[model samples]
Target chain A: MADFFQSLLGNVTNVTWQMAVMWAIGALLIYLAIKKDMEPSLLLPMGFGAILVNLPVGSEALAPIKTLFDAGIENELFPLLLFIGIGAMCDFGPLLNDPKLMLFGAAAQFGIFFTLSMASVFGFSLRDAASIAVIGAADGPTSIVVAQQLRSGYLGAIMVAAYSYMALVPIVQPPVIRLLTTKKERLIRMPYEQKNVSKTTRILFPIIVTMVVGIIAPGAVALIGFLMFGNLLRECGVLDSLSETAQKVLANLITLFLGLTIAWRMQAAAFLSPQTLLILLLGLIAFVFDTAGGVIFAKAINLFAKKKINPMIGACGISAFPMSSRVVHKMGLKEDPQNFLLMHTVGVNVSGQIASVIAGGLILSFFAGLV
Target chain B: MKKKIFAVLAALLILLTPLCALADNPDAVETCPPMVQSQLEAAEGSITENAEIPEAPEAAEPVSEEEGASETSPAKGDQALSFGESLGYMLKGMAGIFLVTAIIILAVVLLEKIGGKKKDGQA
Candidate 1:
């Protein structure tokens, strides 16, 4: 009877305070996911994975999660898979209507590089610095791929930073946007000029972008190619079912796997540290700078343009999808009821998706060349 | 013809000298410098001695490396960059990404122009 009890409670006996603390974190994440509905798809799996790994075991040999991480995250197959879904869901028509919005996408990525240098100042290694900096991309897959590629050893912290910052975009962006721009600047009204994008152009845009970006930044070919392929599936018209499957089934499966596998590195021994705090703090800084970079760049363009551009459109340039764009649109309305910046913000938001993938590839190739 | 014969003879002598030295000194290859020969001999001796040693019972090297990396703290030998150098990298990286973005924007503009022309003609 005693032997049976001992075997049953063996893992319990091995529990440490760190493991207990990690469980509480996992519970908190679960609560947020369920209650706040804050990125439930990602946080739920991540929270569960954290608890699973932190369970006190007689040995450090976590089996399936570790195995999945080695096969998926380490090999970078999951993020690439997720990109297909992201690409399929992306509507580049708005961007096509206003091609200049793509520039804001580029401007927003300034925070990533800026954060890289800042991370190094805080005593992170080159690999860790680069990984932490990618949280500025406001892109989950990009953050995972870069951190994994660099072997940053802080994937758990980095992933949490990227996703949490992404979830908090509605709250985090407004203050930064308001702080940078005046109520007058925020109210600058630009008329919505909708252009009829041709069917052929819609199809060709993905192809041309894939070819051009792939040629210029070969390292990002998988990410760009898969994303473009997904977009192609959507734009082609005949592949509706396949596109839907890619957008829904493929993306969800990979996101679940990506989240859980990420917890392989979240063992309490690795996750409970001061560096994690620094990473979270740095992530917030990067997000602020990203917003500032876009807004400032937009303000700069107003100098050359005959008609002033809405500087809030710049904040939409980060790859938080409809969320960042929606925040900008709401702020525009709050400032002046007549202002309509949804289409404009959406255009810049979609462009940010493309720009971030290109940036990720460039950072990888650049650092690889540097080392 | 005499000049060609003299040139051929000189080439033959240059190539054969090293072969002759090797044949004379069987202990060492003529091409190997003294330092290289000593190092090679030492390596060969060590290899023979190590072949007898049972691989040092698979030391704790891998374990130590894994623990060091997996720990939340800095790895054992990890080094941080100076602020100036980090800033330099950040600027260079920013410049490269922006350049790529510029190229993408240019491509989009050119594509739109051409595609627009085609659509206009079709209309």
Candidate 2:
């Protein structure tokens, strides 16, 4: 009887302060997910997985999760597959209607390169610095792929920073946008001119994008190819059911597993470090600069453009998707209730998605051989 | 319609030529400088040695440049480039992104014209 009791209590004594801290962090993430609705699909699983992995159990207990991580994340399969769904869900009509908005997407990527220099200055190795800088992509899959490809030591921190900042787009973007633009600039509204984009154009957009991106940055072919493929599935006119499954079922399934598997790196020993905190701070700086870059680019364009663009719409040119667009749209509505910037912001937002992937590819091309 | 198709095909062919060349001769791809390669090899060796003997969690602190200096080559530490070099890369990367964006925008504009023409013909 005593032996049985001892056996039951044996693991309890093994719990350390770090494990307790991880548990708290996990619980906090769960709270944020449920209460704040901050990327609940991902954060909740990541939170629960953090707790599950941080338990004082033996290595055998974590074998399954380790297997899943190795199979899904380490091999870079999940993120690519997730891209298919993302591509399927996207409606590029807004962007097609106004292709010039793509420049905002391009300009917004300035943060990634800026952060790369900053990370390098801060004494991180090139591969690790590049990986950390990709957090500015405001993209989870890109961050994961870059970190994995570069063999960055801070994969766990990078993933956490990327997703967390992506979720915090609503909170992170506004101040930076406001700081850069005046109230008058924010109020400057350009009327939306809806252009009829034909069926052939819709189908060809993905194909042309894939080819162009592939030709320019061969390293990004896989990432861009998979993304455009998903878009192709959506725009093909005959693959309606497949497109739906890709957007809903496949994306959800991968996200659920991706979130949980990410916690394998969130082990107390790996995650609890000074570097993790630095990574988070750097991630925030990246987001700030990305917002600044987009707003400044817009302000510059307004110098020559006959019709002024509401600078806030430029801030939507990060890969946080509809969230970044909605934030800018809401801010526009707040400034002038009659002003609706959703279409414009959505155009820039989708363009940002493509731009972020291209940025990721460029980073890989430039640094893959070096590190 | 034939002209538009020919234009697209020609553009695709032009774009595809380089990829085909690169695939045919992978050795043509650029590699790291010899100095950087040597440094990376040394760093990898040290990392492998460390992996042989697992340390306690407390030892898992961030590897400072000074700490890694012993394993790194004398010319440059574990960093692939200095701050100055990274700035150069930044300029190049930003230029590359803008260039690609410009090309894509041009392509979209051309496609829109073609699509519009087709729709008008159908009507």
Candidate 3:
């Protein structure tokens, strides 16, 4: 009875205030996921895993989670594999119809570089700064790959910031978009023009993109290759079942494991630092800059173009996918219900996905050697 | 137009492949000079010894190449660049992305033309 009491009660005594704080943070994430419906697929698992790892249990008890981390995230397997599913789900026809929209994707990545400089100024090591700056990609997988490849110490904070900001795209982008654009610009309408894209073109796109990006930024080959490969599987016309499996089953399974495995690093000692707070702040800055960069680029293009483009479409250039696109579309609707910007914003949104991966690649190329 | 674009792409690929290979070649990696390397090793040894001897008087040695290198070394991953260097990276990165995007756009245009022809033939 004494031994039983010690075994049960002793561990309770070992729990520290930091662990208690982490529990609250975990509970808050769970509440946000359940009640607010913000990235529940990832946030829910991450919240539960946070509590699991932070328990006052011995390291031996948490060994399985660590093993999952080592096998999946540490080896860069999960994110790359997840990219295939993401690629399969994407329909690049919108982007293909208007390839100029791709430039907006490139422009939106300005936030990433801007945040890189800012994080360096704030005294983060170059690897950590680069990893942190990638949150501006508004891309979770890109963030994971960059953070893991760079071996940054703040992987947990970076992952949390990346995914949380991605989910908060609706909240983060509108204010920045409004600040950057006028009501006139916001109301400017872009009529969607659908082009009949050929099957051959659709099939060729992923292959060409992989080759081009691979040649330019070899460091990102794994990311772009897996992504484009999945796209190829989707567009090939014969692999419908495989594509469906990748889009649904494979993606969900990996996301589940990736979410839970990420919590291995969310222990109080690693995550409850001043730097984590700074990382969150920096992530917000990156998102804001990305929005501003795209809007400003559109405004700049309007100076030369014959037709005025709705600058709000530019805000969709962040890689938060349908969320960023939807935010811009809803904002357009609010400005003028007749102004339907969904198609235009979706084009820019998909292009942002490609551009974000390239941005991740460029960061890897530039810093892989320096670091 | 198709032939010219293909020729250009082929030429670009041929020109760029060797550069990529060179970049990835680990043998091309530069190392610190032997003298600097020896000094760094010695400095690291002294620092480790100092860490072990908590009671020892703190040394007032000037910051050496070892310390500077530590800030920028691959092993440390804590390289903090000056604002100017970071800006240089920004410019270079943006330029690289735009260049690649332009190339991709060119290729897409070429592919579109080819695909249009195929569709027309099928129709």
Q: DockQ of all candidates, in order? A: 0.19, 0.31, 0.31
lDDT of 2 by residue, A1-92 (tens): 98999998978999999999999989988998999999999899999999999999988989999999999999999999999999999999
What is residue A55's positional error in candidate 2, in angstroms? 1.2
Model 1 misplaced stretches (Cα beyond 4 Å): A58-61, A369-371, B1-78
lDDT minimum window of 10 residues, candidate 1 chain A: A362-371
Cα lDDT tens digits, model 3, A1-371, are: 99999977877889999999999989988998999999999999999999999999889999999999999999999999999999999989988998778888888989999999899899998799999999999988999999989989999999889889889998999998889889999889888888888888899999999998998888789999999999999999999999999999999999999999999999999999999999999999999999999999999989977789999888888999889999999999999999999888998999899989998998888677655
TM-score of 3: 0.87
Docking class of 1: incorrect
True contacts kept of 2: 0.69
Best by TM-score: 3
Candidate 2 lDDT over residue span B41-99, tens digit each: 36433322222222122222335344764543432223544576676567657766776
Model 3 scores a C-alpha lDDT of 0.83
Task: By TM-score, rank the candidates, best first.
Answer: 3, 2, 1
- By summed lDDT, which 10 consecutive residues of candidate 3 chain A come out lowest? A362-371
Q: Against the correct fold, how does model 1 do in TM-score?
A: 0.82
Give model 2's docking category: acceptable
